[model samples]
Target: MSEPGTPRTQRLRHEAETAAARFPALLAEAQIIAASVVHGTHGRRRPGSGETFWEYRHYRREDAASAIDWRRSARGDQLFVRETEWEAANAVHLWRDGGAGMALASPGRPLKRDRAAVCLMALASLLSRGGERIAALGETGRARAGRTGLERTLHALAEGPGSTRAIEAPELPRHARVVLASDFLDPPETTAARLSALTAAGAEGALLRIVDPAEEDFPFTGRTRFRDPGLGANLLFGRAETARDAYRGLWREHGAALGDVARKAGFTLITHRTDRPAASAVLSLYQAIAGLR
Candidate 1:
């Protein structure tokens, strides 16, 4: 029998409640940041004559008879034709690291997961405003757009799969854009393989590496205990300062390797610390996605 409140299901439910409570603020902040950077411009990539509704225009002599909307034309004295919206709806697949490692953050800083969610949602808001389809990778159902899309993306993020392991390649369309936000602490080769597979499948995207200030700074000195979140393995350092140099070196090399892999795979990588303003990262991510179109 499982404990009343400590069972995995109960813990997950509690987490969902916590995230739901924070969802509004996250959404609002993302909207504000997206607005500030994107302004009202979305830079759509779709052609002028797509299949979505645009407007009704008076029929032109050059227009084909089949182009006329007979029902609309009958209601008005003048012949009228229906035109599709000029905006294109490009597909953008978004994913965030859901590992136990992402749960680590210093006391006064947001969790890496929170920061990643903000960037993902904010970028989605900006992209939706520009008429793009937004899909949360690994979630069921199709990509969405506008307010509905944002809502779906938020719900999925707050309540979906919980794991830190690299995400499997989800099926996407040719030339779609994918945005992955994560702590990216996984092994370099694992990260590289996932990226290469996505590229080979024809989806171009940006990677946002969310780092906690503590992890980046390694401010702890003297005896300190470090535990791997997923493995439950602990390492005790008598003088943590002694390990600081090597730690920093390894971190730098890890970052460089991620960058090299991303470049080789033809994807863009952006690093954002949880303590910094999220707007900068959001804006940069938006520009990168826009550039792909």
Candidate 2:
């Protein structure tokens, strides 16, 4: 490691500062939302023998022989590894879209990107309180629990995923869970495939699609201009109302297709508009991942 005052040290310091500075207000808002959301108790159902005193998980190859509960294993063909409640749901990866299009907002609304970030951070805050291990997609850092886990995840998220629509889903171990937040305005097939990749290891997964109310409602009439921030393309409409019926039809079809894809891939998809309450989306998403909903 480089010593303090060196160029490398300066760069590292700058990075940390930048990450810490990127989302102070956003992080605070997220925590507030998280704190207010109504959380329910998780049921004792999957991933282990329904029992008391200790939780049991299926033994993975990475587990040490010492960690295996041989008595439990002898009761069944499958090997069982025992753990506390703290260790049961830590294999979670969280992602948010950093594309330019996510920056769009209506005149009186918050940005889609901002809402998505808030929802993602709020979920992280909520999960961290449960001692769940949280990691960011593509992060090399080990997943951690509690406050430090939230900080680590936020730092990774601040680095942004770039402007590409294509996602890079890192390899993860079995039983991991992933929650991804984005506008998901891409073609339904593309979005579905990318999301499915997050759970390729038999992990559970969820999608939170952020939307602008204007996009959903098509409230524009008369002359209107639309811009694609990502592609730098613009469209001017003389009578935007004329396209309302077609736009609504296409929008519904797209949503349906996305829902179907998520169903087939065994993933849960939650759509939230910037005009809606972040707490509701966060609550639903948290429940979905925690198996409480």
Candidate 3:
């Protein structure tokens, strides 16, 4: 193991401090987005049901000693209170593409990855407010509910997007919900197969397609040079505008395929441009998720 003040240790410490500093601000934004989606209702879509979903919150002094979740509390310095969901909420698995492509953005625009994170975080907070359980797709163990679930999702997001190319198709419970945000620039067949597997498992969800303005409007002209962000390859176009039609044609084909897949799987398709308001995407995504049976 490295010593306490070693460079590696210091880097890790700095990373932790950065995440710590970001948590509050991130959560606040998420909550604000969540609230904006369904003002004064905590994003609740329906009446409460009797089902129980184990979730966590900070322990309060007024709570009984027996209410403390000793095992979870042991994981950190703070006490925790385990709670049961009193709403008609269910599980919602979440995933976001974390590839270098997602890091792409036009000038003065937020990265696709960043926009995806905001949408995911806002959706998680909205669901948590209504008592829905959430877990990273393909993660081990049960889905977490309430505030802790949102916390866990935030941490997962801060860890960076996992594999950018191939998405996992882990088994989900029947009627379970999923919410995935990505550029979905992969081969249409790959996305189709993943969705097929999940649909076959009796799961339903929404696909929030995050896009960049530059991508949507291939506005390059004379003597333009294009670089592949992932492969680091470069292509020089004498007149990039001449190729715009072909590029857009391919883009349309890809989008059409995705729409077909979502339609076949009975999932909702949501498209958001990074240049647009994140609130609109957040609201649409939450509504789509909430409507999932």
Candidate 4:
């Protein structure tokens, strides 16, 4: 077994491969969910259904019997089937926040933001494999397909120092689908407004808010140092019991506010904790995106 804190170059490659392998199963489920939703630009054709016909060629042995057009058959030496424009794949934008807050480590297992990155990358791989064009963006800027784009995206995310820069909403292409993976510790109002703008511009958006189990439950006890990962500021904390209620209350309030804003903006919000398996969170996000279609 690999030891913790091993050189990321050696260890991360194996991890990325393992996580990428899980994408196929998750995508299978996503396709099933998408089948019942409204058809969007990202949707694939039913193989024989649609109107704006695609080009036809000589019929292949595996061509569906129902796809043969008798009229076209009469005029041609060979018969072929038509595909609809709607069946063509659409582009997907996988935008992840690399801000400092996202780098905070959970008490155990994968760090909160790192886990979210993995989930997003896996989901992106699935989308790309399904024929959709995928563009991945971090806080600094965006990266399109590379020799191994999915792996590169995952590596970049894991190695990122986290964003010190303010969050800005990116202008996406019309009819494009976006998946944002972030801690969302920034001002809820600003974040909400950015998301609303994206929606207004004809882009569909979803948020995966990553949180640490410790932050959610406030399990800290005795005098402890609390540090701001983004700002690099630290403060000494007293016994957890004394401020437990207040901390929990504030956490809940923040979560509620974030949820409300996301709902009002017409974006799906999925909350993920560091302690949980990323697979479940990825599945939930896929389901939500599928629902939007």
Candidate 5:
């Protein structure tokens, strides 16, 4: 009943389950941190307040006595609860790059891209459990929810050999937030411009740069054969120390340039190494985006 290579799907399911087990604690931490930030508080308004509270304000213009914070009034004269409308639940789109470069296996692992997909699925599950609609976008876009939807997304991500087309700007609602997961081995300007377009369209986005440790450090030494998995090509290179300094410098510069692009576009950028625990990276990223830590 299952096709060959479908085991990847099963692996994704297992990873998602493991991630879900840890999500409750992580989310709790995220909430506590988010509470300290203004945007976080605004994003987590009470759902029932829409009908009951007609407004919020600085305790001005004949405000109702019941609505006033008497304790705050004792401390300051300018306390008010202005009328604020309840915001509707928003959706999150998780876009993953399944291109060949992303498929490069970690030195000792089967495939780094597979692991990244699992992480993305776990994150999507966490957000979905928090009442946000979750959608998966890759070569094609699939929108679903709940456990079943998450499974479907994982399966789709695992099946894709790689993306052949260029990254295109997604059309999302003005208030939508996007979580883009990719190694981003593509042209810097092209990727940066695409992300910028998302921000320009009134949607906020976060970039997750999943990288293999080797890519970061160029740890290969002596006579080594470097192969391009996506292109099916191999090349021999000399000792790592020969160009290690220049390579590291360029790598650091690349990261710096990406950071600049993200800041300029008003998006958050997080880089994660495949060798580390994905949960740690995810938690750090959530805190950064939520302005908690």
Candidate 6:
């Protein structure tokens, strides 16, 4: 390991501190987005029943006598029955790409990495609130639940795997859910192979594409300097606008391939732009995981 005060160590320390400082705001924004979605709906629609109190209603003829809330019933002439919401608190593994490619964005847009982070945190907030467990992929062997789990997940994500690297499929419980946020610019076959492994392990989840608007539009004209942020490779274009049609075509093909892979793996894939509202993506994630739509 490098010395404690060395440049590498100092950089690591600085990143940790920065993550710590940003945690509150990041989590707060997550909570806000989660809350909005929660209020707009009844709750998550997952398998299995839960003990958490959902609501209280007047006892009906079809209701079992044992289901009656006796304590509350005694206060009124009418009998009441306690109802519980369906909380299939399954383990949800989250992973966000932090690669250099994800760091790219348009002049007025947030970095793809930042947007991915927000979506991850917001989803965590929703899952935590719904009494589900969460784990960052490749971080822990087992998933965690509640507030502590959320904190642990955030920390792991901040210091976890490199973005440019291939995804390291974690050993997860059977039937566990996963949520992955990335631009997914990787080779389709590579991504497919990894996802296929997870599916074979009985894991199911959603894939989110965090993209920049400029990536789709290709608004650059005249001469342009195109560089690979991760590889540090540079390419100069005399007429970048001339390549727009081909680039957009390739982008579509990439998306189609990803969709096919997701379909085979029994997962859902949704794309969101940095310029769009984060809540939209969060809602889509919630629905996909909940198997709603």
The model with the greatest TM-score is 1
Worst 10 residues of 4 by lDDT: 36-45
Q: lDDT score of model 6?
A: 0.78
* Quality of model 3 by C-alpha lDDT: 0.76
Superposed by TM-score, candidate 6 places the C-alpha of residue 7 at a distance from the truth, in angstroms, of: 5.5
Q: Could you give me the TM-score of model 5 versus the true structure?
A: 0.65
Q: Which residue runs does candidate 1 get wrong by more than 4 Å?
A: 1-13, 40-42, 49-89, 162-166
lDDT of 4 by residue, 59-138 (tens): 54544678687788888677855534433225456766766676578645565655666777666655544444455543
lDDT of 6 by residue, 26-102 (tens): 66777788888887545443565557776676775645689799999999799987755432236788888877798
Q: How many clashes (backbone atoms < 3 Å, residues ≥3 apart in a chain or on different chains) does model 5 have?
A: 12
User: How far does residue 97 in candidate 5 sit from its true spot (Å)?
Assistant: 0.8
> Which digits, one per residue and each the tens of the lDDT, describe model 3 over residues 1-293?
99999999999999889767765665666667777776733445445554475467677554579978899999989998766654213778788787888889899987787778777888887777776777766542246776677777776764554553223545454467888888988897888888887777667889999999889789999999888888999999999999999999999988999999889889899999999888899888877776665
Clashes of 4: 4
Alpha-carbon lDDT, every model:
0.78, 0.75, 0.76, 0.63, 0.60, 0.78
Error of 3 at 13 (Å): 7.4
TM-scores of all candidate predictions against the true structure: 0.80, 0.75, 0.76, 0.65, 0.65, 0.78
Between candidates 4 and 6, name the one with more favorable TM-score. Answer: 6
| Candidate 4 lDDT | 0.63
Residue pairs that clash (backbone atoms under 3 angstroms), model 6: none
Using TM-score as the measure, name the better of candidate 1 and candidate 5.
1
